[model samples]
Target: MQIKANNPDEYIAQIPEDRIPYFKKLRQTILDNIPKGFEEQMSYGMIGYVVPKSLYPDGYHCDTNLPLPFTNIASQKNFIALYHSGIYASPEILDWFVAEYPKHCKRKLDMGKSCIRFKKAEEIPFDLIAELMQKLTVKNWIKIYEQTIKK
Candidate 1:
């Protein structure tokens, strides 16, 4: 949803009540497993895990004022969306995630280039997401971003 939140907690608070637990768990999953150097914040109106500007002063190429986004989770109108920039920039990571999805969840994988959409709340594979979160560090991500995505 289009939550007018100023921070990650505010974004979580603004999500629908029924989804609060799911969102919270998703947030915790990322927080618990994400590599160091990624800070939590509200990014693009969603709960974002990012490389803060302090660490990477260049910031996101698309918007230098914003932190370098690594991943984001949002409660969308129809589903929960997880956006992972690493998977978008690295084919090896993408292929690994794709191959491993079915092993973690029963539902068919519903995904885009960088967005993984979960239509059913209970079907979200938090463990898989946690594993994905640990795959990249700020240094690795910036390198990949520079080599494959930054323009």
Candidate 2:
């Protein structure tokens, strides 16, 4: 199915009927936890919750318009993915997450310099993830973003 949702509502409406619930839950988790600066948009054909350019101009790898230190929630053919850049950028937080949610880390996390990919929505520990998300406040995120921009 071609999901071409323009706005947040439309984007969500395009989600496969069967996966709507999962997507909604994930979306709510991100919405409830992140700060006000974050923007939700369609990115890479998936619902991406980003910390807009004004907040992190050099997103991930200098993509000014893209948001960094954010999460990308995508609905795939068989499962959902909750991609967290913080997992890669901050080892301390990642380690804490792993230690706290061992069951979710049974499989090796597919990570980059700034992303953690989960195959299923159930794999994500919402409460802990929420806590971790909160840790990346605007103040702290800006400091980290600035440091990364320098390099």
Candidate 3:
């Protein structure tokens, strides 16, 4: 995706006007549910929730200046995409998401590794996503991230 904005608001503004409402709803849920120390910013041309540099001075291994990415939300051309490192890194979480999504939402779960692609806002299982978000904290996420890197 193109890096169209440097900040969250700018990123949201760049979203197709028709998609703004869905993005806003998802963004707010993310902000409200994410564990503390995760900073909301524009990354990979989307709204990203990341572990701040203050919490992880080493930053992301791929880009030390950039904070470690936790999750991201983007309004793609055809759908809304949610990228979550926790779900990708943990098989248990991934399984839980896959299983619980259908139980909670009527739409079929459309996902790949860490990315959940929803063609429409209603297709998103917001409650399930919130539950997943609440499952990990900055400390827990860093530990998991490091473990993945070591392997």
Which candidate tops TM-score? 1
Model 1 TM-score on a 0 to 1 scale: 0.97
- The per-model lDDT (C-alpha) reads 0.92, 0.67, 0.85
Model 3 lDDT per residue over 1-151, tens place: 4647878888888878877888888888888899888998877677889999989999898888899999999878788899999998988888888878878888778889899998977667777778988989999999999998623
Considering every candidate listed, which one attains the maximal lDDT? 1
Tens digit per residue, CA lDDT, model 2, 88-139: 5667877877676665456665555544555655565667667767877766
How should the candidates be ordered by lDDT, best one leading?
Answer: 1, 3, 2
Q: Candidate 2, which ten residues in sequence have the lowest lDDT sum?
A: 109-118
Clashing pairs in 1: none
| Residue 43 in candidate 3, Cα distance off native in Å | 1.4
| Residue 77 of model 2, lDDT score | 60
lDDT tens digits, residue span 130-150, model 1: 999999988999999999999
- By TM-score rank, best first, the candidates go 1, 3, 2
Candidate 3 segments whose C-alpha is farther than 4 A from its true place: 1-3
